[model samples]
Target: MSLLSPALRRSPAAASTSVTAAGGADALPLRFAAVGRSFGTGPRARAVLRDIDLALAPGEVVALLGPSGCGKSTLLRGAAGLDTPTTGRVLIDDTPVRAYDERCAVAFQEPRLLPWRTLRANVALGLPAGTERRTGASRVQELLELVGLADQADLRPREVSGGMAQRTSLARALARRPGVLLLDEPFGALDALTRLKMQDLLLAVHRGSPTTVLLVTHDVDEALQLADRIVVLGRSGEDPAASVSQLVPVPGARPRDRGSVELAALRSRLLESLGVDAHRH
Candidate 1:
């Protein structure tokens, strides 16, 4: 059961739409209209986000980038239905998210696996009850293998390395077959080498499954490596006035070479956006 087998690493072009209901033409996946969120009230009120209009077709990967207090994670949480917006709307296939649903899945900064569950079982947890046990098990195994963790299937999260545990979390997300995948800094805690490897693995998994992915991260390099479009957020005044700056598209192809001129230019541009001197380390 090699993790990176051809079966698990199939071409992205062959991916099927996962969360579409049994209906007409899949309804264009997801849409967000003037999405906004706020907190507090009057003089104490704060706007965490505003004017967020975006649409995600099936198979798209968008990144949210910004400083610490900006609303990247808040926006993602709104989309995931984990947090309610004080204003505006978040929609998946035209339906509003008020609670958990099978159409979307989230992977947080931590793997969040139950310590008592093995890697395989954690993934199987996403399956519907009454799913044929063997079928659910097979799907979990397939996803584990896809994320390069098949051999670690029987291990509990505590027994695995952090990177390996995160891969298990990713497998769990994929097992749900959600059309929309929300990732909040899924690789932010990994070591440099492991982060790079996880980046590649994520790209490969996205390719294989082609879900609509929204990733929130502070790491500009990670955004460049994985996002088709990067949205930057910034704080306007002090506590009560933060907002999203702009959405910039990362125009390129898959397996984008880090050293290529186009990628280097993108990296430089993103660094500039962050007000970091590109020439500085």
Candidate 2:
């Protein structure tokens, strides 16, 4: 099956190749150099991630897949500076990340919009602290339009459907014009149809802005549908730490054929890699 709908393929934004960062520079590359994370110390210490050396080209989208507690979220969080790695570094544009920077934006599984804030107001919350009032407002308006939420910009979080709320959350994440967009199962909370639409929306958004994306998801099909590369993490040793076990590139262009023989083969491979026996089912 065609991964992208005809309407999505014909979008004007789909023709754009790159998105501008807050400073108008091109999207930045992301790197994880010997990255590892652990909790506690000594015998009680638990390793969550280990020697995660990976790189994402500017405007590339990479999906991470693994079983629970394999540290996919931890790895993504480390890149976002939400959690510091116990070893090595998470770098953007060659500089080591010390804390959350304006260059990175994250969208979580939950919309997490402030209950009291209007969608526009929530989006504006992502603007840098020093943004001029008018500029911030204009940016919020632009992002809302970008995410197809201009009509609902004034609605409160409770007033919108789950899909619309997620769109609002996405608009908020992009309000800062971040070069790196980190997504943690952003569509996992939605129904199947909504999830598919959101996936298409993400592809269109990426085509328009072309920001570097690191998405963590459990769905193999979702990975094939969106990622340029799928990185599977697993624990090779008895240790709990999860490391990159395989890196599989998704062939063809964006909006790939979901039901094509190629995708089917890849899906089977990925499922096997994830410890699933696709043939038995």
Candidate 3:
């Protein structure tokens, strides 16, 4: 039997109910053109990213993999419009991205839920301005249900487990019905078992919603399990800027067999790209 709910397991003929535009309608693609980011001014500037040229097809799931300080999160933040690139530009559907156009949502490692509000209220905060309370409440309930937190809708953030809180955070992000979802190490704070479950839940959610996903993760297995393509970033000797070192495709559909020989081989190659020897373990 499948672990997903019927709604999630059903193949998406259109986008999820949370879609920003028409439900199940086509989403816009994201593009990064020679992007770069640096902190501070000349002579003291620290470059984080450089010459990052990439594109994400509508509804495709892509993973950014790299060591700490390799600018994976910085790249994601640029796409989210939380940070601007110091060089080049980011575009969505061929339009220059100066700010989030109600088309992007972001989830971070920490839940960052407001302690004062109930779970439902926390989620409702994601709704656009001028939304009626009744409508917002309905959307909150729907998202809570989707993330398996409906029963805990009234609880405060302090009352929930870390994983549950993260789920609530995800629900809040999805509340916007964004076309692009940016995840930055969202499961890194959880235990191994909980992380595995979150990965599965993410897959189920994606299967139902069908949005463009840009996930920043350190786990090779997690990227292999969730991403259609894995982008690896690294820095060269004495250069602070991180650049794309490898961009490899993971050819398969969703619900891929984790133990399949093809994935195993691909995992081996990915590990090598990160300077790890698969045979050692």
Residue-by-residue lDDT tens digits, candidate 2, 70-180: 999999988888899999999887888768877899999999999999999999998878999988888888788889999888899999999999998888887777878
Q: Global CA lDDT of candidate 2, please?
A: 0.84
Q: 1 or 3: which has the higher lDDT?
A: 3
Candidate 2: residue 108 Cα off by (Å)? 0.2
Q: What lDDT score goes with residue 48 in model 1?
A: 74
In model 2, which runs have C-alpha deviations exceeding 4 angstroms? Answer: 1-25
Higher TM-score: candidate 2 or 3?
Answer: 2
Candidate 1: misplaced stretches above 4 Å? 1-28, 236-240
TM-score, ranked from best to worst: 2, 3, 1
- True lDDT of residue 16, candidate 2: 30
| Model 3 spans with C-alpha error above 4 angstroms | 1-26
User: Over the stretch 175-253, how does candidate 3's per-residue lDDT look in tens digits?
Assistant: 8777788999999999999999899888877766777789999999999989877889999889889999888777667
The model with the greater TM-score, 1 or 2, is 2
